[model samples]
Target: MATPTAVVVGVGAERGLGAALCRHFAREGYHVLVAGRTAEKIEAVARGLKDLGLSAKAVLTDATVEADVVRLFDEAMSPGFGRDPSDLVVFNAGNNRQLDFRELSAEQFEDFWRVGCFAGFLVGREAARRLVPLGRGTLIFTGASASLRGKPGYAQFAAAKAGLRMISQSMAREYGPLGLHVAHVVVDGGIDGERLLKNRPEAKAARGEDGLLGIEAIAESYWHLHKQRRSAWTQELDLRPFKESF
Candidate 1:
């Protein structure tokens, strides 16, 4: 069998883990699509993949919009990738607007819901529509611990991601009969990004917060889930560093 293709949405230049996921999948010979709102960032990630002799493309998609999601799925299924709806579709795009409940505004709440749950819904539905026809595929959504428990200060982000978890389990049950696997990954660790590198040098220095679960680790878990048989399908997997407590 040829390498299965993957489409990763919600890529950001510096903050996103999606870029790393693209590199991982492409290295495995999958035709990867790096899609997000930033074209330049996506292109830069794709360029790195090309330099490494892998197939990848940069796509600009505002996942919050239905039309953009439609266009993305269309391009993903084009002849460039052997005309297939992706064997793996990952909706890793999320916007975090964490604010204390007392200080939170309606707009901030909406933003979180839109980017977290709405975007996942948009991407997941389209992936399901295409994969049902193909009769087998993997659809995974990235999640946070906040999604499972709405913390005191981060109500908005918690609610939205919680919605994604519910959606994932529901979709998993709905499509499992057709060989479509749906899994939600709860990334229960602090992500190490440039912000931590610059402002919180002490964290980088002292190895605080367990230094963010490496994107490669998360990507490998995705691959493992993808290869699982129907008899032993998993619905949710929570990932945290050794130093982090559950």
Candidate 2:
């Protein structure tokens, strides 16, 4: 049997959930394809994984582009990598910019939808194309609180996320019978990361040490989703800090 492979898109930041998920899957022996727009960042992540004696390769890809998304999957299945379809594909690409409806321009709104919704569709479609024939695989999308509700100053972000959420559900229904596990995860609270620590220190402090969602904990949930039996697949999951209000 070919060694299992995993592809992670939008792994630009070292401290982000995408990188954490890459590490988790790598640790479990899957040859990881670390993909993102920034070559340096993706390569650094792959290098770090290699340093730990895990198999990983960096593929610089802009998920928003159709050609790039195609190339991403092509590179993942190349002989140099695993030469097999990815057992797991995680679409972590998103743009979260808060803007009041009056201030949100058409360009800005389209940009968010292109990255958050369209890009995810491309990645998920490619994964489904490859996995359905083989009769097994896992595809996960990382969502945010905006996926479930639209609030003030979140018009663009929420609309894009909501689109992604619906797409995830549609894929799950269409492909589940074909043996693909499709799931959408909504992260309802702030993640414990450099961005959070630097920009929202007060929020983190208010939430207590464990108030922020741990990156590892989020990654573990993805791993769990991948491991679930077909008889009990989860179509959607919501994760949040205990202190976070609904």
Candidate 3:
């Protein structure tokens, strides 16, 4: 049998959830494609996995672009190196920022939508087009709490994420019967990752131990989702810190 392959898009810092997912899949003997908009970040992640004697390579992908999304699937479906086409794919591309609704410009809203919703749609569509034929595959989407709730000063992010959630739901309904496993993960609470730590150094201390979501812990849930049996497939899963309120 050819080696199994996994593709993770929106990978950033090595300490982030995306990188953690790559590492976990690599450890499971899957050839991982570390894809992201930043060449340096993705390359670093791929290099670190290689250093650990795992199979992974960096694929520079701007998930928001149509052509880039198409190209990413092209590479995933034709992965050589004695590996099978990607049977696992994750669309983790998105950004969040608090912007007052009254002051939010059209450009800012569109930017958020393009990244969080449009990109996910593009990836989902391509995955359906390719993986549906094989009759088996896993496509996971990384979502935020904003996907379900609209908080003040976060109109743009909430709108975009809510749309993404809808995309995942529709895909799951349309593809589950076709043997494509589509799931959405709603990540609640702040993640204990490089972005949060670097931006707000005090956040870790404020949240306390286990207060913030651990990247590895989050990645493990994704692995479980991929390993789930069809009879008990989960269309949506939520992860959050124990201390988190709802």
Top model by TM-score, which number?
3
* Clash tally, candidates in order: 0, 0, 0
Model 1 over residues 82-113: C-alpha lDDT tens digits?
53458889999887645779888898899899
For model 1, the stretches where C-alpha displacement exceeds 4 angstroms are 1-3, 81-83, 195-199, 208-211
State which candidate, 1 or 2, has the greater TM-score. 2
- TM of each candidate vs. truth: 0.93, 0.96, 0.98
Clashing pairs in 1: none
State, as a TM-score between 0 and 1, how close model 3 is to the true structure.
0.98
lDDT of each: 0.84, 0.90, 0.94
What would the per-residue lDDT of candidate 2 be over residues 59-157, giving only the tens digit for each residue? 989999999998888776563633465889999998786787888889999999999999999999899888888899999999999999998998898
| Candidate 3: residue 176 Cα off by (Å) | 0.2
Query: Cα RMSD for candidate 1?
Result: 2.0
Candidate 2's TM-score reads 0.96
